[model samples]
Target chain A: MAIKDLPRDEYLLKGHAACPGCPITVALRIALKALGNKTILVIPACCSSVIQALYPKSGFNVPILNIAFEAAAAGASGVSAALKKLDKTDITPVVWAGDGGSYDIGIQALSGALERGTNFIYICYNNQMYSNTGIQRSGATPYGAWTTTTWTGKKEHQKELGEIVRAHHIPYVATATISYPEDLYAKVLKAKNMKGPRYIEIFAPCPPGWRFDMSKTIEMARLAVETGAWILYEEIDGQFAFTSYSKKILEGRDRKPIEEWLQLQGRFRHLTEDDMKKINSHLDEKWNQYKKS
Target chain B: MKTAISLPTLGAMGKTGTWRVFRPIIDVEKCIKCWRCWIFCPDGVISRDDYPTIDLEYCKGCGICAHECPVDAIKMEREKK
Candidate 1:
């Protein structure tokens, strides 16, 4: 869909506490536009939890249940069950979590929920680290990206949270970014229509955490997709297909050099030539895995 | 605007304008009225009327509206003392 075709209904109201140019806010806005008012958001200890603001004053137009740090998925599952009991199945229960909550802390609960075929949408707005908690490194933090815990750069590669969730043989799993709102919106709509566990891990960039100019959030997100650092694809009932942008990359379209993406962020400013090459190869490996899948 | 214990009423109740370091000023003559700034504003402070109107009461002056304006219709000016 064209950018102009996106719905203008503001489910995520303005005056939110999110940082200027915050991608998580953007993601939530776009996703909620697609989900509509009949949705209950279950957010854990993440930026959204704080961004949603202190209780008695919320940034969200929809009902949001703030849960424990490691209980987003579990909390969502309970909400979903309650909806079932109340015969309010039309109301979509969504787990909006951060990478810190989903990839590391809440994985066990998420895995169990997915295994039980919980009917809900689990969206991990991955800023690559524990951004809300002061940029501490999380499992989703990419290689060669500096964080408070990883002063030099995170040595290990980002964990494949999508693949791990897909392993549960859920109804749907997808990867997206705020840059591609049409695709993200479409995926959320599709997930909302289907029953069973659905997961979409969005590559949301944190300006303060990633040390990038706040205004460059969209540019940075677009560059990540164009460089193939973050692949956009959906897996449905074990069938994998690359979405719009990633499909082009998979179809022999040359991606922009990884440096174009890396240089835009301060986190990678400390990297040497060899370090960039290492990251490039790591990206290549990841792309190859997606191509094979 | 009834107050209930449910959810905080929408609109700029906090008067977040106090948080502004830079305030956005729109040039009506230059504005195409594309609503990009209105749509992209995180605070939803920009009104989609005949001309874009910023409700400064809630506008935190993030400069997003100015930054996203394609026609350069909006400019971020430093907040006065």
Candidate 2:
């Protein structure tokens, strides 16, 4: 169904503390529409904790458990177990974390929950850096991107956390972005209906962290998929297939040069032609594996 | 206030509209009523009925609505001093 057909109820309320054109809020708003009121969000120390606004008042209409930086999945597991005990099978427990929380700090907790087959949804909105801590490089930060921690550009390639999640053989795993709201909506809705550890990673481009114009947030997200920098797909049980524009790209659609996506962000400004070659070659290798599959 | 549960309420962090440098103005004549602006608005300030009406009290003036609008129906204009 089209975006207009989605529920019109507002779960994320007005007058929050999110920066102008914040990517996290854009993604969360769409996801909450799919999640509805029966959702309890388990948020770790991330931008969302701040976006929920100060104590005693929150922008989010749903109940949120603000946990430590490395306790999102652990907290959600507990919530899931408690809900099951309470016979509230309809209430969904969701872990909404950032790259720093999911890929770096909270990975162990996430893995444990998955291996235990906890019935919950874990979504990592990967901005690729610790944006809440003023843009430090994280495990999800791409190669040749500048962060406060990586002054000359990050030499290591980003960690494939999605692949790691898929290895758990969960009932559902997906990748989405805010640019394609319907794709994201459908994926989250599908995950909500499932009864096992379901994981979703959304490629969220931070406007301030990526050093792009605030208005260009959605454009940056669109270019990411069009350039093949981010591939959207969902894995159900053992079956895997691409989704949305990524499926078209896999079927011989032309991929825009990664430079088109890289050049707009100031984080990639330090890259030389040589650096571009390295990045493109790395991306090619990744795509080649996909092409072979 | 001492309670651990923080029930969400409107304007929790106070009015954020004062942070705007450029406010988006919708051209109703050019508007297609696609709800793109309403869906993309981060703060949930834009409410949709027949046409969308932005609540300036918390509109962050991010210009995302203007940028995402297909018909160029939304324009980002400098806020009055």
Instruction: Calculate DockQ per candidate and list them.
Output: 0.39, 0.82
Candidate 2, superposed: residue stretches over 4 Å from native: B1-3
Fnat per candidate, as a fraction, reads 0.30, 0.79
- Indicate the residue-level lDDT of A182 in model 2: 92
Clashing pairs in 2: none
List the global CA lDDT of all models.
0.85, 0.93
| Candidate 2 C-alpha lDDT tens digits along A1-293 | 77677778888888888999998998999999999999999999999999999878988999999999999999999999999999999999999999999999999999999999999999999999999989999999999999999999999999999999999999999999999999999999999999999999999999999999999999999999999999999999889999999999999999999999999999999899999999999999999999998
- Model 2 TM-score is 0.98
- Reference-based lDDT, residue A256, model 2: 97
TM-score of candidate 2's chain B against its reference?
Answer: 0.91
